[model samples]
Target: MRESLGDFAIGRLDAEEAATVQAHLDGCADCRAELAEVSSVLGPLSTVDAARLGDAPVPSPDLGDRIVAAARAEGRAAERGRSTPRRLTLAAAAAVALLVGGAGGYAAGAYDGIPREPVAVQAMEPGVEVSAVAIPHTWGVEIVLDGDGFASGATYRMVVESKDGREVGAGEFIGTGESKMVCNMNSSVLRGDAEGFKVVDTSGATVLRGDLTAT
Candidate 1:
């Protein structure tokens, strides 16, 4: 049940599995606490720049051994019915270290085989400046955006339009209106089928548009 908390936090579990997890969490105080901790870690990790991960410092050679040791210690504590918080913390730390050490491989697999392509972003309204990059994957496309000059506290949606005039919702982000805004959005629409990308406000007004054909 504890092992499934990570997947449950990210909504990766199937309906039945998720329901079971939810039911268990409703009664398990320890698992609920651990789930909150894991969720906090995942939220920031999701925004990590994968392109820069290649430059991350290599971990110590013994990192893998340390992680395995931590896991074994955690299992031993569980079997003994001892307080597991210390062992759990150690295990979590080891897992995070492993992810940092293997970030290069993770980035390579995440982007698939397609090279990152710069999309030409055109401002749809005055005083708006935005830029985007399109990364195509086997499953679909990921858009990386960096910009400013949006309505603060407003929600913006990314819409990907196919060549046939069909539109697919990519993802959404909140605007800060000040400072640079960075967001990563994904869509199930294949890159080859997408003709353009549009960032629109909640009112359906376009703020920025990008041409995928030239990407």
Candidate 2:
């Protein structure tokens, strides 16, 4: 029931009705998909700055037309070979957020302003995988690490250091071997002078190391 999707998504329905709707969503992929799309459209609006909406600067004259065209194209692509996808409606809402909020520029994605080229870092220890990307403008780098050999229930420290032998950031996280860890080195550590980076365990053993030179 498309009418019930919004109520279910927002917890507005009573427990009995909500449970029944949830069960239907679980068994119906189309309704579940529509719920996700509706959530995307509603979620941003809910959190958006009310003051910003009031004072949002006037977008370009053609921005509205462009957004509609882009949204239609996106909807067509998403709905191809399927029943009408709600993604286009969601896209239109998102496009409004982007254009209006560009005044308060935010990253479109992780590593949004970062350099496109990825610097390959090799794992010094077995069963560890690390991927890192450095951003030139922000002078920041993000590391995604997966360790499949760490102790199951133990807490460990992940450390990052600059090439000049200065400790940039350190954080403790509890993780299992099957999970991925994300580490972000702020601009303080990514000041374009870091020629090397390191990840050390709690015992002060290096798990991964790499050069930061532009690749």
Candidate 3:
């Protein structure tokens, strides 16, 4: 995973580390997008200055269990067919989430928390869009969302829930001069049993629903 927090704006890390990365971000758009992605799922992370940099993010309850179970399922499925790319993507995602939790809070709404307005989800574009594909030896869980055509600098929000009534990743998305987002979650509830995952808006409406995939 990209260990450089060059673009990360708000997080639970200390000053020295945050500064090193922020300096890099001032010139990297990719990092800016990443920082945006993190804030999108979290909240107005821009509110985070270099002053308050070192704080641990609170991971939602049972996220690890949910992730492990999903990973096992993906491993079994991958045994039937190889998918190294998917596994790698998940590894990166898992590592990133772990890092975020180490310093930030599981406080999604704090940064990108959406308004009370209902969400209108666009379809996930193929080829150009990001998708959480099949995972090989997948030992974690993820929630991904993406779309196109937006009003620029738009912020999208998501409230995910496993069938067990536990919130997975309650976050928002900052659009990339367009109306699309991708929130990949590898949470605590994935270690054991979970029926499925569903995405929602601030009003508690369903946007997407399906079983946990391999990657």
Candidate 4:
């Protein structure tokens, strides 16, 4: 019964197991107290970052509840034989929070408040064009890399530097061999007064550098 508490805390119990846990929760005051404690900490997991970083738009207020409800509606949860440990539960909560935040906003195209017109950065390689567009509220910048010179399966890292000399990892993506890659950059550097950007190869050599503040 106590082990069930962990699974229930993280929403990992199946419908039958969940019913059993609910029945126990209805009677065991200690378990119920612990459950409330866990929820209080994890429930707001989805909205914490948006409130802290930049002015990014937050997900629906009911997002955490909705996620739990959706899991219940699935009728099948993760196996009941394995109870998620408390630490793992917390990590999962954070992961869910991030996924719900970025994927939701990106899928909804909720960049209306942000600038759509891209500020073109000088391209280093011939036929290689790069542009950066700031997504307001979310404090993210969308970087679009296109054209040739990108090696297939090569990972390119885009680093942003703030006006204050602080450098931040803006985004990273692998070349798809299609000559185009679009990535979302979420960092304090881009959110703050960004100074410039540098595209580095796997060996950390700066392949391209451009002043983002320049027209």
Q: Give per-residue CA lDDT, model 2, range 1-215, as digits (tens).
A: 66999988888999999988888887665578799998888867788888677785888899989999999999998778454446676788799777745643222233332323355677877877656654443445544443355555666564556667777664555646766544444445653556666666767787777667653
Where does candidate 1 clash, by residue pair? none
Residue-level lDDT of model 4, residues 127-161, one tens digit each, is 45555554433454544343345567888888888
lDDT of 4 at 130: 54
What is the lDDT for 79 in model 4? 47
Scored against the true structure, residue 148 in model 2 reaches a CA lDDT of 54
TM-score of 3: 0.29
- Writing each residue's lDDT as its tens digit, candidate 1 over 6-113 gives 999999999999999999998655578799999999979999999998896989999999999999999997878655877898899898767745663223223333
Candidate 4: stretches off by over 4 Å? 1-111, 138-148, 190-192
Query: Best candidate, lDDT-wise?
Result: 1
Identify the candidate with maximal TM-score: 1
Q: Residue 82 in candidate 4 has what lDDT?
A: 40
Q: How many residue pairs clash in each candidate?
A: 0, 0, 44, 3
Q: Compute the lDDT for candidate 3.
A: 0.49
